[model samples]
Target chain A: MMLWSVVLIPAIAGIAAMLPPMRAVRRSLLVATAVAHCGLVGWVCFATPVVSRDSWFAIDAPARIILAITSVLFLAAALYCVGYLRREEGRTTCDAEEGFLFHNEPEGIFVGCLLLFLASMSFVCICQHFGLLWVAVEATTLASAPLISFHRHHRSLEATWKYLLICSVGIAMALLGIFFLASAGRGHAPGLTLSGLVSSAAAMDPVWLKAAFILLLVGYGTKMGLAPMHTWLPDAHSEAPSVVSALLSGALLNCAFLGLLRGHTVLAAAGLGSFSGELLVLLGVFSMVLAAVFMIRQTDYKRMLAYSSIEHMGILAVGAGLGGVAATGAMLHAMNHSAVKGMLFLAAGNLLAVYRSKNTCDVQGVLEKLPVTGCLWFAGFLAITGSPPFGLFVSELTILKGALDGSHWVVAALYLAALGTAFVAMARIFLPMAYRLPDGSPHDGASSPGAREPVWSVLPPLALALAALVLGVYVPAPLWDAMRQAASALGVL
Target chain B: MEVVSDILVVLLLLSNLYLLAASRITACIQTVALQAVVLGVIALTSAAGGLTLVVVSVTLATMAVKGLVLPWLLRRAIRGADVAREVEPFVGFTTSVLVGAGLLVISVVVAEPLCSSAPADVSAMMIPTSLFTILTGLFIVVTRRKALNQALGYLVLENGVYVFGSSLAIEEPFLVELGILLDVFVAVFVMGIIIFQINREFDHIDTDKLSVLKD
Candidate 1:
């Protein structure tokens, strides 16, 4: 019942959003639903007896955590969307508008798909059936297509095309990988459930297990935006509307990472964990290095954030691969990264709205121009760069400590080096552009220029950033229990 | 016995070379279709048990979808768009083919050692052929200029993926195949709308010229 609430509330509001009603009312409805969903996710994860109905569907602690995070972020974003649309409609009157991105919001295809994407993610997290997991993951691909092309422009179209092609190919490879996984079940219980496979691991064929893990890693890693396989992250994230970016960065990566983790779990049961971990660590380092290289020269702020997302995802993968306390850090970082990054993106949206441009060179001194927003932006910058007093700061520090504790000195050093480089590069942009005022810039959308801190826009990020601070010092018991359960479920100690 | 199937497998690899080397969009489409037919034949011959009617039908369906219908649709789109040759290959055709050949050799060499424990009844050359097809699809994607042609490249790439999926001996491949088809249809449908939009906005469907949207 509670799991249904978590999935159902948004589903209902998403439908309501499609109806011709008061936009504010629609937004309020979404917010109400989201808050309700968060409460229910709390129950399902910590209080409820792990929502499992047969092998087809379930929402365990990890899935519950992800669902709760996405719900909260979605609610915050929905609130921001209400304001963004008013401003957008204001601009829509000026620019020669093509058409609405969707037909009547009541039709609910777009928002319904968003809800469906959420439900499918929950399904992916808990569905014990391997085949269902594949379908659920593929469902996310379909659900997100329209979201990626939300702006419905030419570039959005191109990005959608690239995303579909690359991921479709990747998913198809995953299907092949699934075939290997299935075939590995031959001469055993003949089912692909985790427990079933684990019990029979000693009897399973080594040849097929190795093959399956590789294909699974490549296939799902593509979805997770692992380096050398991360081409789609930038275009998809940047081209989508900012709220969608919040979801993609905050929620989608974890779901895909879970897919890889599932495969790694099977391999670990087969006593071949080291092989996959090595591959994962290599890709993780490569992704971090790639992101750091690209971040320094990137002019588009949205793309820069996209690269940062890749870097964080890389860090998570490396932590998981490093094992022990590092893996624990990865799990904590997942939650913290989602929260801080969600705030940063929403704030970026507010900044972009005022600046009327995405070019970092074009937009500067956010702090002076819009003091409240500027402060939040700077704070988000600090939080994301892993400075103290933020949750991400604690998570990354623990990851480094874990690396050293595990006697992986070289890896620890490399991780530190990458972290420092990313921080410097991000600061190079946020420090001056956010802190220092360039000549002849609008301070606020008022007597000086077309800029002012819209109340609708300002409040969500302020609230979220504050929440990030609160969580950094003290995560609620339910969330901590949820994280622990989720971590344990992933076969982590 | 292995000799004949081995020859067909080698042809599949060569078809990838043809796809990468070919400058003409029509030829790329045809080579991909040809490769699909070859893969279908491989699947048919490689079946351990006597060809079940189910296997027969699957092979025929693979031939129909990947070989005949898809290529035909792509050809119509190509003629409709009036795209003849992809002039600005992202990498030169010769170089792309050479690199593809190198990749093929590497695939066989790398995958050969990995799957050594498997029985010879499963085709040894299957993985290499499929890998080359994957690369070939990627080449067509990067090298092509027109939206329709790029889409064709994408279609071939998908067919390549389908070939790989088929080779993996997926038990419920029919379901997976249907999933693949659904994905392909949605992808192409969306691409068609995009092309139409491109035609409306730019008066042509050349993706290279549709470069106004970049940062």
Candidate 2:
């Protein structure tokens, strides 16, 4: 009943939101559904594992962690959306890309898609069947594509088109991978459930197994924003509304990561752990290096955050690749990254609303303009870059310790170098945006005179930042157990 | 039955080759529809237990969506966008056809080892045919400049995956199969709407000009 409610409530609410013309009702429905979903996930996490009778669905360890992260992130994003919609109501902005005026998509459709996005992501977390997982992942792409182009401009549309094409094709590859997996286990007839695959994995053909893993990695990696396949991410992230960007970074990427982890579990059970691990670590390192290279001298702050997401996803790949304590670290990092990045993107949204520009050079003196957002934005930068007294720092340290424990000196070195570079690059942009004095030169209207930080925007991220700070100083016992269980489940322990 | 499956596999291969050289967007959409219809029949002929209710329903669903509905959507999209042909492809037609042949060879090489261990009831050429179609679909997506054409390529790619999936004797739930079909239908439907918007906004559906948001 609990598992069914968690998925069904959001879907039902999504449909409900589409029907009602009342803005207040829709907004409240969004928040109310998010709260219920988050509460259910919290309860499920603390309780015993829940598996369906036929083993088609289960809230296993990894599912618990991902569900918790996605739900919490969704709640925060939902709260932020209420305020965002309130501010955006009846406003038409001329898109700079084509200098054309357009109204945003209807509020009802936007809210509907948001709830559906939540439902699809929750579905991704709970699905034990590989085929259903593919459906859920693909559904996420379809749900969010409209949200990406909320502004209905050339740039956003272009971003939407690329996102749709790339992810659809990439996920199509994953479908093929699933078929290969089915073929690999043809004689065993273990079915497509994760449990079945893992238990009978040893008898499966190794060649097809390897092919399945590669296809799953490349396919989901495209959605997870890993390097070489991460080309569509920055555009979509920067172009979408900030609330949507927050959800995409903090929630959606983790869902895709969850998909990859499922495949990794099967491969590890098949005794091919090291093969997949090496590939993950290599991809992780490459994403970090590429993000660091792009982050330096970056112009757009939103795009910079997008690259940061790619880098952190790399960190996650590295942590999972190292296994043992590192896999635990990766799980922890997934939580920390989601919280901190969600807060950061929300803060960036606040900045965009007040300053009306995404280019770093265009907006300055955030401290003088919006003091609350500036401070949170600055703290978010530090937290994201793995600075001390933050959740990310703790997770990064855990991953580094895991690398050292595994005697992977070269990986450790590259990981440190990438972190340092990203920190410096982000500092160069974030410091000035937060603290630098605005040049006294007059230019075309950029900063709105009446723009001020709203309680809605400030409160949600404030709660997230507090959560990150709390995690850094002390890891909760339940979460720690959950992370370890997730790691062990992946065969890393 | 084996001969029919073999001929269907050959037809799948022929459709892939035709897509590589086809310049007209409408013609490309038609070719994909033909391939999808062929794959639906292949699903029927290649089933291990002859033909059951489950097999027939799945085949009909595949045919209705892939053969009829999706191509219709693409046709409407091209009509709305006024995009008649895939002119000035990133890779020329001659070169892409040559590449398609190479991809076919690669698919055979890749699938040869797996074919030996595949179930006896399944067509011997099933794996290679699916792989080749998949490669060609990807090829078309990459080399084409038109947004509508890229969408067509995606549909073709999905059709290839369907062929491969149906060839496997796994008993996936009926709901899951329907869910997959619904997803593809929605994907193409969404793509068509976006193509219409793109045409209205940009005056052309050329994806190359969507270079505004990079690095």
Candidate 3:
């Protein structure tokens, strides 16, 4: 019943949000539902997740970790939405006359779709059946489409189209993979359930299993924004509203990676771990190299952030591939990345609201323009680049140690090189935006009319950044335990 | 029943060729619809032992969605966009058809390994036919300019997966299969809405024009 409520509450609230109502009331629904959902998720994560007899939607350690991260991120984004929407309402009148990017659709659709997106993502986290997991993951793609095109412009439309088409096609391949897995398990009982597959892993046909894993990696890897298939990531992330972008980066990407982790679990159980791990490492390194190349000269701040997301995903993949402590680090990194990236995207949103531009050149002296967001943005950059006194630094170090302990010398070397290049690239873009003096008139509408930073917008990102900071210094025992269990669940132990 | 399934497989292969060679958007949509109907026929005749309620329902659902509903949606998208009949292929029609033939040959060669494992009555052509359909759909998606055609390609790709899925004798639950159909329907539905918006925003649904964001 707890599991059912966690998945169904947002869905019900979303439908209600869509009905005729005041925008304020609907937005309130988003906040209230998010708070309730967060509370429920906390309960489920701390308490032993009540497993159904059939194991269709039970909360495991990994699911708990992902759910906690998603719920926390959503709570912060939901709070930010109230202020973001109010500002948008203020801008729509001016936008109509000025012919700018702020074409306000009914806020109801945006709010509703966001809730549905949460629900689908939650479904992905908790679902125990592989078939249902696939459905939920695909549903996430559908639910987020309207959110991507919330502005309803040519560029957003194109972004939404590419996101929809590319992701749908990729997920279709995943379905093929699922079918292949089913075919491999032809003689097994409890078919397509995660536990069943794990238990019967050794009995499955190797040929089909290999095919299935490759296809699944390509399919979900597209969603995880691995390079070569990551064309839509920059466009969609850059074009979406900042809050939605935060969720996409912090929450949605992890859900896709969770799908890949599921594939890895079965392969590990079957003693075929090396095959999938090697592939993950190759793809991981390639994604990092590509992200490093693109991040070097990127002018759009949001696109640069998107590239950083790709690079971090590469790190997570590499950690998982290296196994042992690296897998544990990968789990910890997943949490840290979500916290830091979520903060950065929200900060980026604030920057966009202030500057009315995504390009780094158009906006300058963020420190002078908005003090809190600037500091948080700087901290976020440090955190994401794995600087000290941040959780990411600890996690990244652990992964590096794991790689060395395993004697993956070349992979470890490339990993460090890519990290260095990415750091330099991000610093090049970020420093100028943070410190350079403003060239344009200080009183432009680009800056908020009063030059006062709203608390609603500033606090959530600050909270997230602080969370990452705290995690860096001391990971709570429960979180460490959860990470261990999650690592072991992937057969690393 | 085996003979009928084989003939349906042949027809499905031919439709892939027609879809590759076809220039008009409406004709392409119709050919995909025809393939969907053939897929339904194959589903009906190829149930492992005999027609169970689950198999019947799956057949009906596939026919309704892939055959009737999706094509209608694509056609509606076409009318809403006021798109030209020309598909505006990136590769020449003759070249694509020749490529399609080559893909068919490759699929057969690739599927040779699986023949031993597959059930005896399952046509030797089933795996190759499905693989060819999937590749052709991908080709259409890659080569075509219009968003609707890309969607049609997606449908073709899905049809191929469905054909492959049914070739296996595993008795998957009806609900799971139904869920798959619903997912495909919704995907096409969402694509249709995005295409309409693209038409409204850009005044043309040519995906080639969607090159604003790049490295």
Q: Which parts of model 1 are misplaced by more than 4 Å? A: A1-43, A47-54, A90-113, A152-154, A440-450, B1-80, B84-88, B91-128, B142-150, B173-181, B195-215
Docking class of 2: high
Model 3, position A44, has a per-residue lDDT of 86
**Each model's C-alpha lDDT?**
0.71, 0.89, 0.88
**Highest lDDT among the candidates is held by which one?**
2
Candidate 2 interface CA RMSD, Å: 0.9
Clashes (backbone N, CA, C under 3 Å), per candidate, total 6, 0, 0
* Candidate 2, RMSD to the unseen true structure: 2.3
lDDT of 3 by residue, A1-493 (tens): 8888898999999888888864558888999999999999988888975554457778988888999999999999999999998888743433321255546667888899999999999999988887888889999999999999888777788899999999989998998898888888877646788888988989888888888999999999999998879989999999899999999999999999999999988888888899989989899999999999999999999999999999999998998888889999999999999999999999999998877788899778887778898899888889999999999999999999999999999999999999999999999999999888766555443663335799999999999999999999999897888898888888855
Q: Candidate 3: list runs displaced more than 4 Å.
A: A22-24, A49-54, A90-102, A439-450
Model 1 interface RMSD, one decimal: 3.2
lDDT measured at residue A247 in model 1 versus the true structure, 0 to 100: 81
Query: At residue B85, what lDDT does model 2 achieve?
Result: 56
- On TM-score, who's better, 1 or 2? 2
Write candidate 2's Cα lDDT for A377-491 as tens digits: 9899889999989999999999999999999999999999999999999999999898776676344335534357789999999999999999999998977988999999998
How many steric overlaps does candidate 2 have? Answer: 0
| Model 3 / residue B65 / CA error / Å | 1.5
Candidate 2 lDDT:
0.89
Model 2, B107-133: lDDT tens per residue?
Answer: 999888878866677778888989898
Best by DockQ: 2
What's the distance in Å from true for residue B57, model 2? 0.9
Could you give the interface RMSD of each candidate, to one decimal?
Answer: 3.2, 0.9, 1.0
